[model samples]
Target: MDTTTAPDRDDWITTPLTAALLRGALELERTGHGLLPHRLPARARAQCTDPQLAMVESQPSGVRLVFRTRATAVELDTLPTKRNYTGAPPRPDGVYELLVDGRPAGRGSVTGGNTLTIDMETWASDYRPGEPGTVRFDGLPGRAKTVEIWLPHNETTELVALRTDAPVEAVAERGRVWLHHGSSISHGSEAAGPTSIWPALAASLGGVGLVNLGLGGSALLDPFTARAMRDTPADLISVKIGINLVNLDLMRLRAFGPAVHGFLDTIRDGHPATPLLVVSPILCPIHEDTPGPGAPDLEALSTGRVRFVATGDPAERAAGKLTLGVIREELARIVRERAADDPHLHHLDGRELYGPADHERLPLPDNLHPDAATHRLIGERFATAVFGEGGAFAEGGTSSPSAD
Candidate 1:
């Protein structure tokens, strides 16, 4: 484990956490105690009143603070909102990943902050406030280098202070910006750490900066979300659609097609020619053929393990209910049709990233989200499929592949 200690206050230099020093967040909100990073702008956030959307957008999956300093020791004070299920096992502390000059250097975790407790059976929640905690790292080389502190992907953190042994200056970012939006899976659920999330991992591998707008359980083709994506500047963009819609049973097939079209249309209004890829859902056995309104498996929950089961009937498909299979087919056709006029449009079958074979080796722990190993696999595959040679976002690459 990385070491944490209370260093001499007089020896430390404090820096203000400003927008320039941060990456992958669309907005920074001032709180009573500190600053909080948000993935959606104020306009979009005001359009939705859902608490789940509000919470996940503030999680900061790809948000990190970057600066150049010669400090051997660094400390950041943060107030994190940690979630807990009423009956489920306690979750591990959220990790703060430190990277020096773009290489992993150390990892640390804060001890105390705020807590959000949820009743799994009743779906009610309680919030308890706590004092801020410091995440400290020491024993550096003391040579001038770029430092990046990646915030925890699953926790909503308020940045209170940044203290270093030496003066720090903001470092300007380089490389292409890849903006991606998807469901909870893309939001980094079940991943071990912030940077370990598939999108962050893929961004590093692809040599691109990432702006992840993956709203957990809220990527249901919301107009506000599409508008947010439209306004955010990015060179490469992708939207992973399906799982959330299926699991929530939010819409029927009739609404699904037009919703996707409008979502893409909204994005194109701002980024008319940016390389955009549409990804279908990965191979999820439960929702592949069956429709869903997924429900928690009470039997597994009783055993201190959380699992999900699909509740929608396959017979509902006759009434135009959506399933993963139907979604994949519709997405492919839509991309193909749009690619004819919109040359920059492309599509990638999510199964190519996580198919049956991969699932057999590493099944989803909750029968919904991928495990850590699966996240790495998906990230590697995504980097190759979208950012590799002849891929959609590759330099000089033109024409969208219908399926890859």
Candidate 2:
């Protein structure tokens, strides 16, 4: 039998977990139930009835709790909202990773959480609430050290309470905060783990603090999202555009241009000179030329595997519809024109991270998102291109094209 008791404040400092210490999550909502990590703020989430957005925002893909601690054993109470598939293989439990002083330490998972079951054809879902789960890690070095608890990238987490054998304090963040917004790929897609995701990996390699706003299937150029980014405190910012716009068929080229401009304009209103990088979509052959309202490959689905197929016709390009190729060109033009006036803005071709030849070497398993290996590849490539010597975001992030 295990005997554990909550320690007094003097024995363990209990700080109200706030957004300041969280990474990857965009916003934090303090519900009466707990602190819910949200990819979209209350204002943004309130405006949407889309099930996909709701699910994506709630899934704290790269979210984590970091602090300096002297405790050997630590515990956190969390309410995790897990998704349940109707006919697919039983989904695995969301994982929690513990790192001590920048080294891998231990891992755990919370059990008996709420589940949301969705029907593929109807695009409908039913939510069932369950009790919260407690995550515990022990057997660390008894001396003071930095401790990071990585939240599940695929689960919506409501932080309840934190307790440790000894005192814990927020770590003094060392580098600039890198605020990033992107699609499912940035939300971790099918990455092996939360911190192992590309953005997380890149942040680690680049020596930057991370605030990942990677909302899966929901990275459309929404004004609210741009406003959210504008309001957030960040030393550096990046927007990975195109994939969601292409896959959702949400906007044509005509609307996309203004929307991209508007999105950048909103961010600039608050951070006019902050280094902002605009990244176009990586190579996805299906959506390279074919336009989309992408559909699930029914043949693969029947075999308990998920795959995507572009449904829009290539001939629709004349109609101003969007494809990755069209998006890349427009993004380049937007950044070039804007950079003439806004010297702090820069653009990077996403293909530089994952291009055609690289695609041939490491193909996306689902025909959409990158596999675990590809995520690693993208992360390494991004770190080298944007964080290495003389890169776009290299020194202090003041490097942008000279204004015309």
Candidate 3:
């Protein structure tokens, strides 16, 4: 494998099984140039076995992998919890394209979402040691320039293993750095494919390295989280906030406005005038102008049998105080006004990432979060708006003036 490519562009490669290893680990730590588990599987008590990550090839240029997590806790929601926000649960599967030098190699899949518990020692599947396991991508292009790999969402994956038929060395190179954070949407909820997920796609399109802080259901404007952002190194940064805020009803308008400013302010504390874009929540019918701490209208969902509290509308927000749009508009105004003094700051509407037309074609199966198609759409838009030629992701003007 002629793997001499620029580092940030397309250097590191992972096996399709990388997603499987991340299935449900609690903490991931880097190990021997790869990553290792910090916490055992939640259901390890049953000796969960047959947990091998398998990859299969498909026709017309595509790849599929099945991550079999045999454990008592291996439910349909193994990858992601199904809620109104994450649309519907996808079958436990992965679809991908085998690319050589960014060209198609083949397609693959594992085909089922089964939850079973087996003896760890009894699980005797061959631990394949080559890039090509049972199915191989023959006829790889002779002039292949680079290889790229994508992973599935909901799986708590780590870079545990790497194997290539041809030997390649790990090389480091400098490229644009991207730091991003958001909700489960940013976690790749129901996207068509791993690489197609918005953040991954945008990174691929923008030719930037990524530091994905997109924790699932954890984008709350916690002071420490903001402080974390303030200290992290980044070339381009974007924060997609608001959805989780509304969903959780975490703060009232009085506290919300200042929190937003403080979050940005903390970031500015470090990178005085970095090209920072604050992305507001995209269009969501519920919680637009509503104060949350939502109560589920059990009568509305179940046919009188089951009852639970669900999300609320935007108007009910903070004593009818703040809507997401209100926050978005207010944020832009704040940034623009502040930009006079902090010229490196910027703002972007999340809708520009994915809006109505995107919904019509790829409606959220659950009316809250986006599906895989919408993920691609949003990734495309984000790339075009911020990092494309003259996009916001560009280094642009920095306050450092004399510093390179």
| Best-fitting candidate, scored by TM-score | 1
Per-residue lDDT tens digits of candidate 3, residues 1-404?
A: 32232233133343433433332222344533344332222232123222321110001011112222111111111121111111112235444334444444454433322222222223333221222112223333334134443334443322334434332332232477777867768767667665666887788788876656565556777565566567667777778888777666667677877888888888888877568877878876555555454443444334422222335554454363566777777777777777777666667777777676766777666556787678888888888878765556664544311110
lDDT by residue (tens digit), candidate 2, 305-384: 87889999999999999999999999999999999898889888999999999989999998999988999999999999
TM-scores for all candidates: the values are: 0.97, 0.93, 0.66
Candidate models: Cα lDDT each: 0.91, 0.86, 0.52
Better of 2 and 3 by lDDT: 2
Q: Candidate 2: give its CA RMSD in angstroms.
A: 3.2
lDDT of 1 by residue, 1-404 (tens): 22344358797899998998899899999998889999999998899888888889999999999999988888999999998888799988899999988888989998779999888778789999999999987877678889999999999999999999889999887878999999999999999899999999999999999999988999999999899999998999999999999999999999999999999999999999999999999889999989999988888889999899999999999899899999999999999888888989999999999999988999888989999999999999999988898888886666555643
Angstrom error at residue 155, model 1? 0.3
lDDT of 2: 0.86
Residue 257 in candidate 1 has what lDDT?
93
List the candidate 2 regions with Cα displacement exceeding 4 Å: 1-26, 400-404
Which candidate model has the greater TM-score, 1 or 3?
Answer: 1
**Candidate 3 lDDT trough over 10 residues, lowest sum:** 54-63
Taking all chains together, the TM-score of candidate 2 against the true structure is 0.93
Best model per lDDT: 1
Number of clashing pairs per prediction, in order: 0, 2, 33
